[model samples]
Target: MIFPTQYSMLSTEALKSYLEEAYGLNNLGCKLLIHNVSDTYLLAGVDDKYIFKLYRDSHRKLDEIKAEVELLNILKENGAKISYPVTDLKGGQIQSFNAAEGIRNGVLFSFAEGKPTHDYYDSRLQTIGREMAHIHNITADIELQNPRKVYDVRTTLIQPLEYIKSEFTELPEEYAWLQSTTEKVVEKIRHFDLSKFSYGYCHYDFLPHNFHFDEHDNITFFDFDFAGKGLLANDMMTFYVHFFFQVMLKKQSQEEADKNFQTFISAYRQVRAVSEEELAAIPYLGFAFWVFFLEFYQLHFEDWSNTFYNLRFKKERMGWIRNWVEWYCRF
Candidate 1:
């Protein structure tokens, strides 16, 4: 399968060759499945199920991969209802392959049995809350051997502003708005004390897409690519901000949005209750989180030439930012 952009370093032939060579399979029935334009993921059908994830860029280091493997294994050992990395017969979790293209890393994982929860399920939400809380509880005491770097909100906001001013001058209106809004956001973030919040190993990137729901509505979380040491509130804000943008913003009525938001918050609070101070900080951090994702897409757009960021989705995200900023200012 050809990758969508030039930045993607992995080629189909290279990946296939590496897999065949690594597993010593003469002929393996492998099909490319769920290639997220940003990352190449393949689901090869072996005697059992296995997933091969090919890193598209060099931004991720081997150490990060090892941390994820170790963290997942730890969670699995603690009975967290999450999938762990599959080991080869030799009992190796990671396999390094040197192909002509580059040294790409790949890992195998047992096929997690479940579907993504598209709509809200109370039990599933409760389970997710409890599981996430349990994960935090387990990792809170254990020091991260290789903690990933913290994502700076100010840096995230500034990069896009610079890019728009230096690179894309065509969309004058959008660029102007982005610049002004980024300035205001930067000002707001400067006064906020993020260090005061509780810090620990957070999922960092939990969304409906990353979760799997079994027939019994049990949610199993996956894809710990962005897992690292960060503020617990930051992780919660990230998840809430995404859900607000993707689900709440689309609702036609205020009641509908409020109801959905309450359900999510209620479920979340049940497992890990947020303090009043944390609740107050949500509006600010929520805006900061939106800025992070906004810049995240901008970084992708600049790095990957063929990326389509879904303009409508971005507009909705900006709406969330504007509303949160307004709400915070009033309070």
Candidate 2:
């Protein structure tokens, strides 16, 4: 018997054959695009293209996967520009594969046209803001049959620290700093009038890399894997993270970053109402974003990217968090 395998890479050829049969496509080509928590594949045909994402059971269970599909369908129906899932001939949106580790789920999405752009000119910033607001308009207060993850203090701040404590055994000072900073963020958020905050489903990872801009300058957002129920401000906070990195890397000055972000905020306000208080809460919310991903990286180290999560990465990540706190947070 094959030794109990924890993770397995599905054969690209087998997947191509299976998808051709499953979707009734001809002359298809399948190649691995990314091998992260969930595996991504690029499927090309003579006339069209599609993205196939295979979810790891450990990363996203079937229920959560269904929730993601359901959310995408709703967004598509409501005219949000997203790379929605394609249905098979049998009217099924999800495909189940029996792998060495057990059953894995996959979905085929209409390929988002064009490429991701790093430069956020005024037009692109406006487009990003409007598009994000469009999504928020649809996702706000929406309910799904299957539940996705919920972002809150417990899940994003407290639990992440708990999950990553063991990894910081050798660097107790860093861990302690994280702990104290998390407490400060939690307290600050608690003091806010959260009842006035816009409540909704959020694409919690709204970074530039998750979207593409076509030649026509139209945007198509994809990779809703980390979407969940949370404050709508969480989405804005995530987008702000893009600017934070730009400033951190010295690609742009703080003034340029803030100006760009303000441009996005202005465009967003044209579509939806955002409270000043919610805007003020971004720093605290951004802290949770970093901490949550730190735990995610630590948790998925073995299967996600073992080499990328070594001691050096941990120290670098800690530095990032510290910088975030110092630059953004008062306490």
Candidate 3:
């Protein structure tokens, strides 16, 4: 009898063979691209490339995986520029593999042309804003048959704080600071007129890495791993975080980053109505983003980021959360 395993890495060669047979494609090659919360592989054929993502049972269940496929299909059908799932010979979008950790699901996605860029020229900023607004228009008021998370004060702020408390047993002061700041954030959000906000399925991670711009400057958005129900402004908030980091690292002046963000907002307004109230709440919401990811790192440390998740990393994350509060939050 074999010992039970917690997690396992699938063989690239076996995956290549399986995919070729399942999709009826010849001359296929597979290589692991990323191994974070999920495993991503780059698949290349004679003339085309594709991405295959294998999901962990602990991260996304079958139902949530189906929801992602459904969402991307809808977006593609509506002409939203995105990297959607590709069907196999049986017209199936999902493939299952029995790994050491039990049943794992995988999906092959259409390759998004071009590469990701950090330098967002004015024209590119406008493109991002317009594209994001177009996605929001479709995601808003739509319901998925499968379950997905909802980002709220409980999930992003309160619950994450609770989940990470055990991990901070050795750092009491930092944990206390986190609790104190969360209270301030919750109170500040309490005063907002949330009814003015547009609710939708937001791509929680809208950083430059999740999108690509081709030679002709056309953009295609991918990686819906963290898509969930939330304020549509949450997408804008994630994009804004890119600029915040630029200013923090001294790569761009605060004034310049702010101006660039404004350019994006203005373009977004051209397509959809965004209120001053929702915009004002971005800084507070940004706090939730940090806290949520901090908890995420702690939760998946053993499985994904074991090499980097240490005491020093925790303290560094605490500093980031602190900086976010001092630089952006009020009260």
Task: Kindly report which residue stretches of model 2 are placed more than 4 angstroms away from their true locations once superposed.
Answer: none
Better of 1 and 2 by lDDT: 2
Model 1: which ten-residue window has the lowest total lDDT? Answer: 1-10
Stretches off by above 4 angstroms in model 3 are none
Query: RMSD, each candidate, Å?
Result: 4.3, 0.9, 0.9
Ranking by lDDT: 2, 3, 1
Give the TM-score (vs. native) of candidate 3: 0.98
Clashes of 1: 0
**TM-scores of all predicted structures:** 0.78, 0.98, 0.98
lDDT of 1 by residue, 1-331 (tens): 5334434345666666666666554454555665552354554554555567655444567777878788888888888777678766566777775544456566766667778855665565567667776776666656656546565564446654575354335456656766676676667656666666566777767777778888878777777777777667666666665555544456434455456555665766766665656655566666555655555565556554325666665565556666766645433
The per-residue C-alpha lDDT of model 3 at residue 288 equals 95
What is the Cα-based TM-score of model 2?
Answer: 0.98
lDDT of 1: 0.63
Per-residue alpha-carbon lDDT of candidate 2 for residues 1-331, written as tens digits (9 for 90 to 100):
7778888999999999999999999898999999888899999988989999999999999999999999999999999999999999999999999899899999999999999988789999999999899899898858999989999999999999999999899889999999989989999999999999998889999998999999999999999999999999999999988888999999999999999999999999999999999999999999999999989998898998687987898899889888888998875
Which candidate leads the pack in lDDT?
2
